[model samples]
Target: MKKKRILSLCMGLFFSTLLYSQMVGIKTNVVMDALRIINVGAEIGLSKKMTLDLYANYNPWEYKELQMMKMLALQPELRYWFCDRFNGHFVGAHIHGGVYQAAGIDMPFGIWPDLKDHRFKGHFYGMGVSYGYQWILSKRWNLEGNIGFGYARVKYEQFECKTCGDKVGEGHKNYVGPTKAALSLIYVF
Candidate 1:
């Protein structure tokens, strides 16, 4: 129910922004790709100093062996740039929602314990503010580096088996930490 509402709302915003913006662009998050997750996004110029970015990422490979992550995330952000439409320093506010499954991984900062004999699956959503820098490579090429931090609320259910997924328990976590980190390669049109 909640996921449906959020997805509908974001889809609506994506379409509306597509219809209104004069300049639009496509981007790939290299950080995600390097980690075996697929990521793509669109950027719409909103004003002389502002832009809207909508991005989605997914990890489709096996989580247990290599990546240790299985998830899908949708993030939309409004950015205020300091110089021009897509260059220089910028600040952004973003909201994101996603589904995740984790198991047998000892996450950094005590974010996750070694679920050596179990797994967790559930949803999470949060908002954050970020600072970034964009460099112009050519007339239509750009490179961006961004890091965001704020809060996250995760709700998940434990499973007896990482593969079979037999439910055992449920839990929630509140975190104050990094929510987004992106190194994007963008193409403008």
Candidate 2:
């Protein structure tokens, strides 16, 4: 019910914005010192100074011994361009809503009776804000970069087995710290 409504609303917004002539772009980035993050993002310009962006990311790490931790996220954002050109540069702000998954945690309240190989899954809601600059490389291409901070709250779920089985109950809650760093990219129309 609620998930359907959310998906429908996102689809509606995505299609409704396609009526304009805008620049489209894709970006990729890797995060350092952490669990090795891989990020991909897409953007559609609403105007010269405003646009919408959708993004996703993944992080892979090891939990304790018998488990692995993988985190995935999807984010949609509204960006406001602050400067059109400065030394052949562009600047903007990105406000984002993020959804995420965290895997391989302990089952809450020992939901599983045996507790042999039960796996845990977590869902999160998050937000991010970033300021960035793009340097023009050609007529329709540019090099872009940004630094940002983000936070997330997660609720976990319990599964009896690694692959298939029964789910016990709602999981646990986690508060994630902010992310601060840079993402560089090549933009195109």
Show where candidate 2 strays beyond 4 Å: 1-19, 30-39, 58-67, 85-119, 158-171, 174-176, 179-182
* Most TM-score-accurate candidate: 1
Candidate 2 colliding pairs, count: 2
- Tell me each candidate's TM-score: 0.89, 0.58
Best by lDDT: 1
Q: What does the lDDT read for residue 184 in candidate 2? A: 47
Q: Could you tell me the lDDT of residue 47 within candidate 1?
A: 89
TM-score of 2: 0.58
Model 1, 86-187: lDDT tens digits are 889999999988998866676766667646557788899899999999899999999999999978888999987767756888989897889899899999
Which residue window of length 10 is worst by lDDT in model 1? 60-69
User: What does candidate 2's lDDT look like per residue over 21-103, in tens digits?
Assistant: 36677656544324466676667776777767666666665556555556655666676777643113333433333343334
